[model samples]
Target: MVSEERRVTLREVARVAGVSVSAVSYALRGAANIPAETAARVRAVADKLGYRPNARVGELMAHIRQARPLAKAEPLALVYLEGDRATAKKNGFAQIVEASARLHAAHRGYRLDAFWLSEVEGNARRLAGILTARGISGVLFAPTVGEKRIELDWPWADFAVAVAGMSELSVALPRAGHHHYEAMREVLRRMSAKGARRPAAMIEATTNERAHRGWQAAWLAYGPAGAARRLWLYRAGEKNELAAWLQRLKPDALVTDNANLIHAAQAAGWAEPNERGAVLSWHARSAFGGIDQGYDDIAAHAVDLVVTQLQRNERGLPDPPPMLLFPGRWRECSQTSAGGHAPSLREAMRCAL
Candidate 1:
C-alpha cells in the first residue's frame, strides 16, 4: 500500500518564494495592498510545491485565535521626534498625543513602546536597528514639533511606518494630521458670521510653507476680497512691521494660528479676544476658543494607519503616499464643540492635495 503523501506547509512555500509567511498569506488572499506581481509569483511557487490549503486546520486556528485572550500583544514603536525623552515628557502636547497613542495601541492588541529620536543621538539608522532587535514591525512617528525639516535616512523597507503629522519629514510617508486649510476656512467663516468683515490672517512664513500654504490659500479662497493681500507672514523681530501692517489693514478680526498673534495684537492696541474677532486655528490650551483639533483622534488615526499596513503585510513607502487630515471642530461662544463636521479623509484630501 502507498504511504500517505506529506502535506506542504505555508512556511515551505514562503521559504521557496523568498517571501514572508504573512506575505504568502496576503498574496493568496489577494489583499489589495499586496503587489500583483508579487502575488502572482507566490501563487506560481505554491502551485509548483503542491501546497494545498488545510480548511479544517485553518478554521480550527481561526477559532482558537478568536477564543484566545490577548496576553502576548505585538510590539509597536511610537517615536517622538522632539527633543530628548525628558523634553517630550515635559511637553504638554507631546504628552497628550503619547497617551492617546498608547491607549489606542493597547486597544488594537499592540503594546506601544516609546522611543525618542533625540535620545538616540538623532541617529535614525541606530533607532531602526534598536526597533528591529526588539521585534517591532510597525512604527508610528510622532508629528514633528516645528517647521524644521527632519532628515532621516532610515531603512523604511523593513517595517510599516506611519506619521502623525504633515510633510515635515525628508521622506514622504503616510501621515495623518490637522487639516490646516479647512480649519482656517472654518475659523474665518465663524468670525464672519459673528459680524467681522475685514478679517486678516496672521501666520509665520515657514509655518505656512509647512502647512502647504493652506492658510494663505484659504485666506484667498474664503476670506473677503484681497484678504490674501492683508495676510501678515510675521517673523521674529517683525513686531514693528506687524503693527504698521495692522494699522494699514485695520482688520476687524484677526484670525490666526500663532499664539503670539494675540500678544502682537495687544501691542498693536487691538481689541481683546472677546471684543474683536480674535480666534485660534488650534484651540487647545486656550480659553480663546476657535477650533478643537481633536488631537486624541489624530493620534489614534496614526496608529490605525500603521496597523492597517501591518495586517496587510505591506512595507516600504507607499506610492502616492496618503495624507489623512481632520478638519477641526469649531468651539464658539458656548465653550462647547459646536457643530462643524469634518469631511472624510478622502474627501478632505481632494481639497488639500
Candidate 2:
C-alpha cells in the first residue's frame, strides 16, 4: 500500500507560507497588521493542508484580541435582588438562572461569582468595587426584593448588563428570560382552537405583566366576537379577593400565571373545559401541556451578550433599550402529551407567528 501523506500542522503550514507561527495564528483570526499577500499565503496553505485551529488556542487569542493590561480576568457577576440566603434559596426562578450561568461559564473557562447586593450597604458602591476588583464585564440582575437594585451605572458604564426577571428597571439594558406574552398567546390560541371561547385572564400581580399582555393579544386575535374578557388581578394584600373575582367571571377557559390559580378555579367548581362549563389554565406546567420558556437559554444568552460587549469594548447606552425580549417556544415546556389536545399549542401558533 502507498504511504499516506502526513497530516499538516500549524508549524508546517507556517513554514510553507514563510510566516512566523504567530502571524499564522493572527491572520486566521483576521487580526490586523500582517501584509495582505502574507495573510493570503498563510490562508491558502491552511486550506491546502486542511489545517484546523485548536479550540483552546482560539479562545486564548480571543482574549488577547481585546487585551487591557490593567484589567483583571473577565469574571461574571450574578446579582440577585434577594440578598438574604434564605430568600435567595427559596427563589426557584433565581436558582434556575444561576445554574444556567454556571454551566455556560464553566464550559468557556470563565468564572461566575454570586454577589448578593441585599447584604451590602451602599449596594451600588459595593458592587462597583466588586466589578473593579474582578474586571467583571457584565451583570445578571435577578428579580428585585421590594425596590432594592444595584444602581452601578458608574461602574458598569463600560460593561454589559442584563436582567432575568421583571422588565421594569431603572437602568436600561438588554434582557433574556421567559417570553411571557408569546407563551400566554400560544396557550390561548391553542385553547381557542379547541372551540373554547369567553377566555379570561387571571394573572398574579407579581408575575411578569408581559405574560398578561400575551394572553390579551392572542385572545383578541382569535377569540370569537362578543366573548367575555375578564382580567382578575391577584393580590396578596387582599384575602379572598381572588376567589371572589373568579366566582364572578366564571370564564370557560381561565388563563393563570401558575397552577396555583388553576387549583383555585377548581375549588370554585370550575372544573371543566369551556365546552363543559369548566375553565382550564391557558397553559399547563405539567408534562401534558405548558410553556417552559427555557430559563437556562435566557441565562446563557445574557452571559453571552455581556461577554460580547466586553470583548468588543462597546459601552454606554445613550439609553440602552429599556427592555430586551426573547420569544420562547411552548414545546420546551413539555416532552410528551401537551395535554393530549387535538391541536397542540405549537401547531396553533404556527399560523400566528
Candidate 3:
C-alpha cells in the first residue's frame, strides 16, 4: 500500500503561479480586477496541483465576506416601468418592496437608485449607455402591472440582471417573489382548523394573472372539493350579482385578494366570525386575517443574488435563470379590541372553544 499524497493548499498554488494568495483565490472564482492572462495562468497552476476547494470552508469565507461593512461607492439600479408609481401605490404593491430594497442594499454596502424604463423610450442601447456611464453593472427590475412582457434594446450581455417578481420580461433573469401557492394552502389549513368545511375563494381576473394564476391554481388544487367553490373575475361593483353568488355558493369562509370584496361581503349581509369567515390572501393592515408576503425578505434575497452575480462576474441573462420564493407569514387580526389589545391565533381559538 502506498501513502496518499498530501492535499495541495491555495498557498502552494499561489507560490507556483507566481501570484499572491488573494490573487489565486480571486482567479479561481473568476473575480474581476485581475488580468485575463494572469487569471488563466493561476487556474492552470491550480489544476496541475490537484487542489480541491473545501465546500464548508468556501461557505464560511462567503459568510464572512457578506458580513463585512459595505463600501458606499458601488450602486445598483431599481428599474421600474413608466407611470407605474401611481398604479403600484393604488394597488398597494410597490412601496414595501422599494423601501425594503433600499434598506437591504445599504446593509450590503451598495446604494440602490431608481430609474424608469420609459425614460429611454424602449431603447435598450441607450439604457445600456446610461448604466455603463454611471459604472452600474447590476439592475433589479421591479414588478410591472398590465404589461405581460417587457422589451429593452440594451445589451443585456454586459450586466447582471434580476427581476423582483414573476412578471415576464424579454430577457430571462432570476426572480424573487412570494410563495402564493403555499400561502393559499396555509389559509385553507387555518380556515379548516376553525371548523370551516365549505371554504370558497373570490379572485379578480387581473389579480390572478399578476400572480401567474397562483391564487386560482392553489384554490382549485387545495380548496374544498366542488365545482362552484372557487369564483374568478369577482367584481365588487356588481352588488346584486355578488350577493346572488354568495347566496348560491353559501361558503362558510371567503378567501380574496381585494379588500373591497370584504366590504361587499359585509354589505351582502354575511356575518363575520359567526355565520361566515373572511380571509385575505394578501396582507393588508386593515385585514382581519391573512398572509404577509414577506416583501422585506424578498428584497434582501434579491440584493444578495445580484451581489453574488456582480462578485462572480456573471453578467447578462443566466442560461437557466433561478427563482427564489419566500413563504408568507400568517397574521391574526380579528381578536383585537378598540383599546389596542390583541390576542394571538392560539389564544383566540382557545377563547372561542
Candidate 4:
C-alpha cells in the first residue's frame, strides 16, 4: 500500500540521492557548482519521489523572510464615473491610470479589473454581486459622473478603497493625484525663470476650480505685480478671441488646460515658441512645455495604496493619508536649444493631432 503522504518532501528526496539538502537545492536550481552526474541523480530522485515545492509553505516563508510584512494577495476594481465635460477629459487620464495600474498589478501578483458604473445598469446590488463572486476586495474609484453619486453595495470597509482627482471623497476615502496647485505654481515659476513675465492662464469655462486652485495659488504666490488675465477659450468664441487675448495680455508666457486653446493659438499663428511666447500644460499633457505630474506614478501609487489597504483588511476610507505628490518633467518648448535636436512640444502636439 502507498503511504498516505502522497506529497513528497525535498528532505526525503535528498536522503535518497545521498546528498546534502543544500546540494539538492543547488542541483535542482541548476547552480553551476553541482556536477552534471550528481544533479541528474538528485533530479531523478526528486522526480521519483514526486517532490514539489509546497505553495503555502513557500508563501509563509516569503512573508517571514520579508523585512516588511508582505501584503495579502487580493483582486481589485477600478470604477469610472460619468459626467459630460468632466467625463470627456477622463479618457486620457483613464488611459494613463489603467496603464500604470496594469503594470503594477502584473508585478505585484494582484489582479486589476476596470468596470464602468454606467454600464453596470440600475442595480447597484448587481455591481456588488459581481465583486463578491469574483472575490475582489479592493476598489479604486476613477473620476465618475452620473445623474447621482454611485450607490455602492459592497462592504468597502472589508477591502481597500481609493479615489483619483481633486474632488473630496464623499466617504472617508484616501486620495492620490498630482499636486495640481504646486505643479501649476512650478510651471509659472519655471516659465518665469525661462524669461516669462506677467504670465497668463487660459482654461475651459467648465474646468474645475479646485483642480485649478493650485495654479491659482501658485499664481498668487509668485505672480507679477499686476494680475494676469484669466482667459476662457470656450467662451473666447471664434472671432479670434484667443489672438485678441494674446495681443492684449502680451504675456511673456501662457498657462492653459484646454487643448483647443493651444490649437487655436496655433491656428491664429502663435504656435512658435520664440523669446516672446510660451505655453505650458497645467495638470494636462501637450506638445507644449509643462509637467507630467507623473500621471503614471500616481497611477502606480493608487494601485499600491489600494492593494496595501486590502492586505491590511481595511475597507472604506478612515482618513487615509494623501500620497506624496510626484513632480513632473519640465521641458523647454524650444528644443532647438537642447544639445540633441529633439522635437519641441509644438511639433509633437501637431503630430499627435
Candidate 5:
C-alpha cells in the first residue's frame, strides 16, 4: 500500500495529443466527424498512456441517450443481402426482426443504417471502403430468409461485427439466434406430456438442414417409439404425402412447422377437429398455436454484441466466435386468432403442458 498509480484522464490525453477534449472524445470513439488518421493516432497515444474509460460514466451516458432524439444517434452499419426480403413473406418475420434491431440500436444512441451487398456488387473491398469513409466501427449482418452461407471476402480486423437471424454465416464471428435444438426438444416433450400418444413431427428437409437437423435430431432422441417412420421429412410440392402418412400413423397429435400440410390433413378428413398439434414457427402459425422464436430478442443481442465490441476497442473475428441463443415462446390459439393480441416474445410459454 506504499504507492498507487493514478488512472489517466481524458484531459491529460487531450493535452498530450495536441487537441481539445472534444477532439479526443471523437477520436476515441472513431466518430466520423474526426479524420480516420487522427482517430488512429489518438487511440495509439491513449494506449501508450494506459488510459481506461470509466464504465459507470458510459452506463450513465447510455441511460441519458435513451431520452435523446434519433437524429443525434451515432451511425452503425446494417449489412443485408440485396433483395433479401425485408417483407420476407406473408408473415413478415424478416421485416419485424430487422426493425426491432434498428429500434434497439436507436435506444443505445446508435442508428442502424442499412447497406445492401448489392450496393457494391458483393465486393467486400469496396464495402469496407464505404464503411471506413463513413467512420463506422460497428457492423451487424442482417438475417436472410433462405440463404444459409455468405460468400464475401470481408476484412474483419477493422470492425466490430456481429451477425443475427435464422441463417448461419459462412464467415465466423459473434452471432445471436434462436436455440433451435432446445426449442425442438421442448416442443416434442410438451406434445408427449399433453396426451399425445402417436404424435408425429412433419418437417420439410430444407428447414431441417438449415437448423442443422435440430428438428430431426430432437424427434429421434425424444419422439414416441416407432415414430421415426411417422416423422416424414418432405420437400415443397410433395405435401400430398400427408394423407398417406396420416392414414399410417392416425396420429392424435403432431409437431410441425407446416400449416399448409396440417390444413391438407384436416380438410382430407385425416386430422380430426380435436387433434392436438404444435406449430414450430410463428411465421407458419395458422388457427392452431405455435412457438414464437424470439427474433426481436436475437436481433437486439446482435446489436448489443457489436456495441460491446466497439466499447472494448475489439475488432476482427473473435476466437471460436461466440453465439448467443434464445429459446422459443409458446403461443396459444387465442393469440393466433384474427384481431388477436400477441404478447412479447421474451415472455415464457402461456399454453400447453
Candidate 6:
C-alpha cells in the first residue's frame, strides 16, 4: 500500500532545492534577482512536490503590503467649475468640500490638486492633457453653482472620476451629497412635533433645480390629511411673490432654502417664528436654525469613492451611477431668554404684537 503523505510545504521544497527560504520565496514570486535556471529548477521542484500557495497566507501578505506606507502616489484632481473666485467662495459648501477632500487624500498617502475649469478657458481637451501630463488618474468634480452645465471633452475613458453633487456635471458619475429629501422630511417632522399645524416650503427655482427638486418632492409628500400643501417658487431678480403666497396660504411654519425669506416674511407683516414659524433649509450660519448638510463627510466619502475607482481600474461614467447620501443634523437657532431657556414662539409673537 502507498504511504499517506501530508500537504507539500515551501520549506520542504527549499530544503530539497538547496536554497534559502528567501531565495525560494523570491523565486516563486518571479523576482528578477534570482537566476533564471535556479528559478526554473525551484519551480520544477515545487510543481513536483505539489507545493501550492496558501490562500490565507497570500491574503495576509497582501494586507501587509497595503498597511505599509506608500512613499508616493498619483495626485487626485479636484475640478472646480465655478466661473470665478468670488463665485467659488459664495458657494460656501464647495469650499468646505474641497478642503475636506484634500485632508482625507493626504491621510491616504496621496495629494489632492485643485484644477479650476475657468483657468483652462473651458477647453476640456487641454484639461485632459494637463491631467495626463501630471499623471493624475483620479478626479473629484466639485459642485457647480448656477445653471451652467459642465461638458468635459476629455478622454474620460482613461480616468477614474466621481462628482460631489449630481448638479456638478451633465455626465453621469458616482456622486456623494447630502440627503436633501430626507432632511426636508426631518425638518417637517420637527415642526410637527413643535405643534406646527401647517408647514409650507418656499425654494428658489435655481436652488431647487440644483438640489434635484428634493425639497419640493419632500414637501409634497408630507402634506397632512385634509390640508392643501403649498410650494412657492422664487426666481432670481424676479418680483417677490412669497408675500402674496404667505397671505393666501397662511402657513403656520415655513421651510425655505433662502435666508432672505425671513426678511420677506417680515416685510409681509408677519414676524418670523414668532407670528409664524420659519426654518431655514440650508443653514450657513449658527444664527439661523436649519439642516447642517455635513459637507465634510460628503467630501471625504467622495474622495474615497474616487480612490476606490482608481484602485479597481474603473474609468469614465458608471452605468447607472451610484449615489451616496449623508444625513443632515438639525440645529435649533431659536432666541434664548436671560435664563438660557429658549423663549416660546408664542411668547415672541406676543412681544412682536
lDDT of 6 at 236: 74
Instruction: Compose the digit string of candidate 2's lDDT tens values, residues 1-353.
Output: 11125545668888988888899978875688988888888889887776654333434455677673332335678876556667767866667778888777544445788887666754766766767677776666765535233445345565567776544555667766555556666766766665666667666555434353554555456555643347655667653676676677656666655645565566767755532221222223332244556666777877766555545555555354445555555542322234654345465343222
Candidate 5 local distance difference test against the native: 0.72
- Say which prediction, candidate 1 or candidate 2, comes out ahead on TM-score: 1
Return whichever of 1 and 6 wins on lDDT: 1
Error (Å) of candidate 5 at residue 251 is: 1.1
- 2 versus 6: better lDDT goes to: 6
Q: Give per-residue lDDT, candidate 1, residue 102.
A: 89
lDDT by residue for model 3 (281-312), tens: 43445435667677767877887778767655
lDDT tens digits by residue: candidate 1, 1-353: 11127777789999999999999989976798889999999989987876655433433454465663222117789987777777887877788788999887754546789998877888889999999888887899987758888888799988789998674888899988888888888888788777888878788887888778877888888888787688888777776687778778888877777645765676777753453444544434443446667677889999988876665556789998777999867664321223443234443223211
**lDDT tens per residue, model 5, 114-223:** 78777677787798788888878688987766635666778888788998865666677798987778888888777766677878778888888777787788788877
Candidate 1's TM-score: 0.71
Model 2 deviation from the true structure expressed as Cα RMSD, one decimal place: 10.0
Q: Is candidate 4 or candidate 6 better by lDDT?
A: 6
Model 5, runs deviating above 4 Å: 1-73, 82-91, 273-275, 282-285, 334-353
Ranking of candidates on lDDT, top first: 1, 5, 6, 3, 4, 2
Judging by lDDT against the true structure, name the best candidate. Answer: 1
For residues 1-353, what per-residue lDDT tens digits would candidate 4 score against the true structure? 12337766677888999999999889976799999999999988876775654433433555565543443445678766543335534667667777778767644446678776566764545765677688776777775422134445656555567776544444556767667666666776777777776667775543435454565666666767665444333443554567877777666666776545655665666644543233434333344565655667777777767765654444555764655565555554442435555456655554222
lDDT of 6 by residue, 1-353 (tens): 11125656778989999998889889987899999999999989877776755433433444465663221125889987666556766776767887899977754445799888788888877887898888787888887667557666777777778888656565778989878788888888887887778767777888877787777777778755533347767687653676777888777777777656765675787544642344544333533456777777788889888876665455777888888997667766554454665556553333221
Worst 10 residues of 5 by lDDT: 344-353
Tell me the TM-score of each prediction against the true structure: 0.71, 0.65, 0.71, 0.66, 0.72, 0.71
Descending-TM-score candidate ranking: 5, 1, 3, 6, 4, 2
Relative to the unseen true structure, what is the C-alpha lDDT of residue 337 in candidate 3, on a scale of 0 to 100? 55
What TM-score quantifies how close candidate 6 is to the native fold? 0.71
Per-residue lDDT, model 4, residue 289, is 60
Give model 3's TM-score versus the native structure.
0.71
